[model samples]
Target: MARDRLHEMRGRVAIVGAAESDEVGRLPGKSALMLHAEAAHNALADAGLGAKDVDAVLSTGRQTANDVPEYLGIRPRYLDNTQMGGCSFIAHLQHALCIVEAGVAEVVLITHGESGASRVGMGGGDRFAPDTPPGQFEMPFGIGGPPTRYALAQARHMHEYGTTREQVAEVAVSTRKWAQRNPRALMRDPITVDDVLSSRAIAWPIHLLDCCVVTDGGGALVVTSADRAKDLRRKPVWVLGTGEATCHSIISQMPRFHVWDAAVMAGERAWAMSGAKPSDVDLAMLYDAFTIVPILALEALGFCKPGEGGAFVANGRTAPGGALPMNTNGGGLSYTHTGMYGMFLLVEAVRQLRGECGERQVAGAKTAVCHGTGGILSASATAILSTER
Candidate 1:
């Protein structure tokens, strides 16, 4: 008989600190970077560590996001401006470990910010025009805005899977139930699955409620060696494993519209590296920009049999007292949807593992999994964390 694998990291690379600014529905004076810096300061303070102790900074490049190290006034031995989309923050976790292993940095900082509620668009033009390497397939077709692009993806999902209007609504209803218990959520009243089905469709198979709300918010995290985390003021949530992968971005030319292969690729890598399995994770903080994204991701991530996700998340399986407690912070659906909602998932995951969540907390949550999808299923990332450290 095979023996259970020991907690893979045994408490190695740990998240010593994490934070996010208040979910501002609207903030006039706070620039995007200022909010980011504020979160960074809070995280550093939570860890009982100083800015000077940070040896590297990981910035999530946004239309107007700030640099983590530059704004903090630190000269780290390592620096990474990794801007890969919503999943970039999780990607930064993976990148920071490599940097630390290479002896380039001892402590790392990751920060993300955006003012989407203010209609703040980056790239210095009418839309997101990333001209440096050139946004090969993103900018030209007006396939740029998240809502419009998600509409296209949702349409394809229904076409291929026989996915119903009611089933998609279930995702929102279930998450909203959890959101009602969260004080940080921006939209919380109580929505039934029928309410979602009745809402006006933004596009076919894409209702107004199906889309995520845009807000101006930012989040940050401080990572250090297991040795450092144990010495810090707070408990350490070990980064057992992480992975990132991308598919072709050319929407018209994508291989298949029905599946999310990136999530599979990244999920398998993260699980293997951590020596953990789907059953090992007690909770999941899935990136839910649209109702349909998580349904597809459940299959792609191997949480359920392909094509059975509709039933998996049905029957209150993802509700408060769920078999697998999910999106306890309301997620992008009810919480906040900055340009990159993915970073917020990580912040919430760390908080859950630390048992810091008050009402919506998952009981005895020893392990957590964070999944982020970027650029309309163009890229994906995964991270497994535990509180053993």
Candidate 2:
């Protein structure tokens, strides 16, 4: 019955508009809320719609749900502030579909913005308070922030599968190759596997080059029923399927150190609903908060078998001219990563399908798989987007 419901939901909603802020890197001047409003306005204009046309609003960041709609001067009939960390926006796509299908709302707007580098308007607070689960358990063990926590998994991946550091470095090298084609990317210079290996080491097996860049940016998406999307300004990028799952909140509690079971569950559900396999994916936008994240995602999402992701990405397979283009926008590794990066993944996927990516465009890309990992592999969301309904 659940399978039938998922099949029925396929292609019922489409993303009509997508946009990022006017500027995406090192914006200490723009407050987090300001970035949100700018991206929201641009997306509405992209859809040839006004703020008044939106009946639903969804956003996640340092701000509250009421704060976003209020600042946008919108009184949405529906509102969602589901905060699942970086993957919140991708999960929002799933919520929007359900809302539209149930006739609860139409023309849903999902937005995200953050001041990761400048820390302009982000209120003062320790992410992991003394009383919090992470503060009590993980942080006390000197496992704070992404690098230290993720190192545990990266080292385990190497121990379990003979995955070499050179193979991991290839991910950074290949992603930078794509960044070289993107004028908007923060890091466009060519890099070799040796460069990544020689870069500063943040944690065991995780080099500085393997980590995502810190920037200030925002991105937004507009979704509506498939019927209404045909009348919008841009070509409707159909939302064929979406799935989200969670495994653990703290890194210590992760079920398996090397594998991302949450991503596996999400990807399986997404593939089942879309009726598309990894073989059918023309492009992929897997989150790259760290190189290992995408490598693990490749295996978890069925792009490659477990323990084979390092090999899958080693030979420029995900580079600009590769057979399967991944992270054409340079990804969080080289592109803008404003704390939460899943929204940008969706924006790039939509633009690639619309043939608006210019030099970085993947020619004849009809199907895209966007997968996001949030909070130390604690949460995962997968979206299957296509040019066809």
RMSD of each: 3.7, 1.0
Q: lDDT of candidate 1?
A: 0.79
Q: Provide the overall lDDT of each model, using Cα atoms, as 2-decimal numbers.
A: 0.79, 0.92
lDDT of 2 at 343: 97
Candidate 2 local Cα displacement, residue 224, angstroms = 0.1
Q: Each model's TM-score?
A: 0.91, 0.98
**Tens digits of per-residue lDDT for model 2 on 93-138?**
9999999999999899999888889988887667799899988887
Among all windows of 10 consecutive residues in model 1, the one with the lowest summed lDDT is 1-10
Candidate 2 residue-wise lDDT at 36: 92
In model 2, how large is the Cα lDDT of residue 138?
74
Kindly list the per-residue Cα lDDT of model 1 for residues 117-214, writing each as its tens digit.
Answer: 77543334433456622255566656545666766666777787777778878889989988898887888999988788888867667777888888
Clashes, model 1: 0
